[model samples]
Target: MTRRDYYEILGISRSATPEEIKKTYRQLALKYHPDRNPGDKEAEAHFKEAAEAYEVLRDPNKKRIYDQYGHEGLHGAGFEGFNNFDDIFSSFSDIFGEMFGFSPGRRSGRRRPSKGADLRYDATITLEDAAAGTELDLDIPRTETCEGCTGTGAEPGSSPERCSACGGKGQVYRSQGFFTISTTCPQCRGTGQYISNPCTTCKGSGKIVREKRLKVKIPPGVDTGATMRLTGEGEAGELGGPPGDLYVLIQVRPHDTFVRQGDNLYVEIPISFVQAALGTTIKVPSLNGEVDLEIKPGTQPNQVYTIKDQGIKHLRGGGKGALTVGIRVQIPTKLTREQEQLLRSFAETVKDTVKGSGKQKRNFFKGF
Candidate 1:
């Protein structure tokens, strides 16, 4: 079968730079990798096609020849001889490991002892508590270092022995084709030691699951999705390694009256039609307490009034944010017969005054 253009196979332009070409190849390779799309023949074919294209285009001399006369120009040019599929696969595997934050060089020697996995705990606090900053005691269930045998995982009065599988080197070598690769010993898991008589308390795991109470101090201005890290508060490590970290993910409860944006607080205050028409000082709720706000005469609906420094405190350091009160003018929907009659009379008098005022008439005409 005739092969497609290398650039077209990788979905890149002929003039694409080297960096752009490599990026496109990586994306396609990741999407069609055999491990990711297991048992899919079409995906595997596409993956091989993209890999072949990358192998040719990545080299400057081969790319120049291919660009000049296409693939046929490079016929019998030893391009296939220079390309090693194993090397390409290894390079792409390293790219994936770095992207996903996994162990690098999976088959290279004994892997570094795996760190204890990070632990996450959800902490829910009220908006007020978040604004003021509060301390909380959390009861967490997690794996801790075993007190029995001091985390040795060996039976009392006995000790673990060096693993015979890897001869205490913690790694085993294997020959694939002509290449020799070293990998961790499956028996001892690269620890180089094994407990002959396992500890009954921890069952040779060197750790036990227990409930612990931790005190956490939450700073002010912490919103939902905020995360705080506590050092060395996570799971116990294996074979005397360092413990992992604990992450406290914050979840702020919704407030009854206020919505927070960063440090700013927003709230909608309803004002009667009479209060909006006539200027008055009314008390409004704030983070600190109730504060009086002056509503100007002839205030329109959705007008915002800002109170300085009355919002949430800054999470880092420095000044607080402003509290914005959005005024919502409420028009009365229900009224008594007497109130309806009075309102109608008031409306008629206002119309008569507008007709009598020359300035009001000119202003109305100007708007038109």
Candidate 2:
């Protein structure tokens, strides 16, 4: 081990930031590389020094210990520097591989198990079904693990071979100016495995697209924009991971009779002005059925009345909402000769009720 300071080897300030240290190390490594000065032992020594300095400073843990207690602290912590050129190249393959134009080997853990993507299903249900809870069978098209090859993408009793293009790393490297760019291998398409003998059922893919029939239960009082999640019902996973979820979005269709807001139901009932003036009992439409509602005398237009427990049911709690009925009083547009005589006789009994305008009073007695 060299007795010189790590920062001094990389030609950076002692209080330099991590980025500054890395930049200085990159310049030193590029300048004193053995490839540029093949026969110069001094340049080889400088490259080793820069690599060692970078290997220490790039790591926060080792850098902290070194910053606090120096090289002896790193030694006590069991951090021996690179032994040979192979070690330096292998350790910095991610950095140097990108700096130069060589493919970095499979060091990233990209081959681990990955969960499948989630799926969405849009369903429109009648408002009655939404209020009363119903069960439905849905036809869904999705990919599942192939039964022929058991998700291996190969013929039965045969295994997939390692990708030759990417050497099972699933990535290909190409020299682009001063950087090496990595991309998915065209031959293997990032699977890192090649299927020479493919399964006849699903071609070479590890999954198959098929329509699945599933029965789902919808709770009462589910409105539009409500979402339900079904776990493990989505596309099949890759590398033996768990399957994803299926999201069911529900849209409740509009009703012709009732307008729903939250748990309440509203309906307008039109009554004649005669009925509005005199108390009467009438049948009102509700979620359950026709129920009787009483209208008091002199009931004004647009007046609202509530019928208890006649609206939509609660989703979680066990109860029902009230039904709101709005009164709409209709006046007679035309009257017969006998009807006008009867109205004129009635106006004489209640003359004080007809004193709004002079024109209206004149019109009331104009026929008489």
Candidate 3:
């Protein structure tokens, strides 16, 4: 049988970190899981290949041997690839535990108190606000535990009854050929209990939807797609569990004059060709204010200069980054008659000077 390089199989470089390998494998598994692909043979093959690569690379010893000696090293140590889909499933019985809900393995013989779902809020702010940092009130709509029955889904006086189908285990286990599959109990919907007398406020769901005003602090230098987590601000947890978090997705509006890279700000300052020949000082725009920048004599176009402490503040409390200014020497698009005549005279003078010096002619305009 032929085998592909494990790194290539997983679409990762050989220098990929362990966390990177795991994250990539999780993505590939979700995309090619047998359940998701149904009857696609190619998808199943890819799924198996990714799983095999992950299994070897995750183990330090196996990876070391495989890196030193190719696939033959594993075969020499009595390790062959999975024989079939059943073999792969048997090896990783609860592989989808953290991924899909198929084999959640989330239940713990009793109702588990899992954290509530995390919420996301998209916020658009001005670039100035991102550079200097600002605070904003975000209205987050989420679920809160019903106060009437204290999240029991029962009326004030009455309580829920244990589910008879699952015997309060919250799941039903059944044999599927060589595998035992666990699914949510249909009678209780994984809640482990049935509410005979439902709460009037939450309507037997044990939670109520409400909008909350949360004040979130936006840190300085936060770029677009930056996610800030507000702890314990998500939906109320199930049963007696802790609440999840709220992630704020920040999007900074584009600046009119500056482009930012990391903490550095880039701005192009257009100067006349005369200034390029004889250097001059100009006021450059920065996040703070206008700063004087000195241009050197015979400065080339697109020459970059750095203005210290004029960029965005550090996300964490540190000094500001630099503002980089690129010089753009603008040539005259249309020349006046006198200006054209003067330029032609200058060129002729330089050509005559070169010939008189008994030197070979060279392109002198390149210096400008």
lDDT of 1 by residue, 266-339 (tens): 99999998999997898989988999999999998999999999999988889999899999999999989899
TM-scores, each model vs. reference: 0.64, 0.67, 0.61
Q: For each candidate, what is the lDDT?
A: 0.80, 0.84, 0.84
Candidate 3's clash total is 0
Q: What is the C-alpha lDDT profile of model 2 across 1-368, one tens digit per residue?
A: 44789888887887888889877887887788666677899999899988988999999999999999998999999998989876887687666656754334424313556788899999999888999999878898988889999888899989899999888777777777766677668888877888999988889787999999988899998989988899988998986778788999999999999999888999999999989999799999887889999999999999999998888899989998889999999999998989877777788777634543354767769889
lDDT (10s digit) by residue, model 3, range 230-315: 99999899887989999999999888999988888999999999899999999998877889999999999899999988888888
TM-score of 2: 0.67
- 1 or 3: which has the higher lDDT? 3
The clash numbers for all candidates, in the given order, read 0, 0, 0
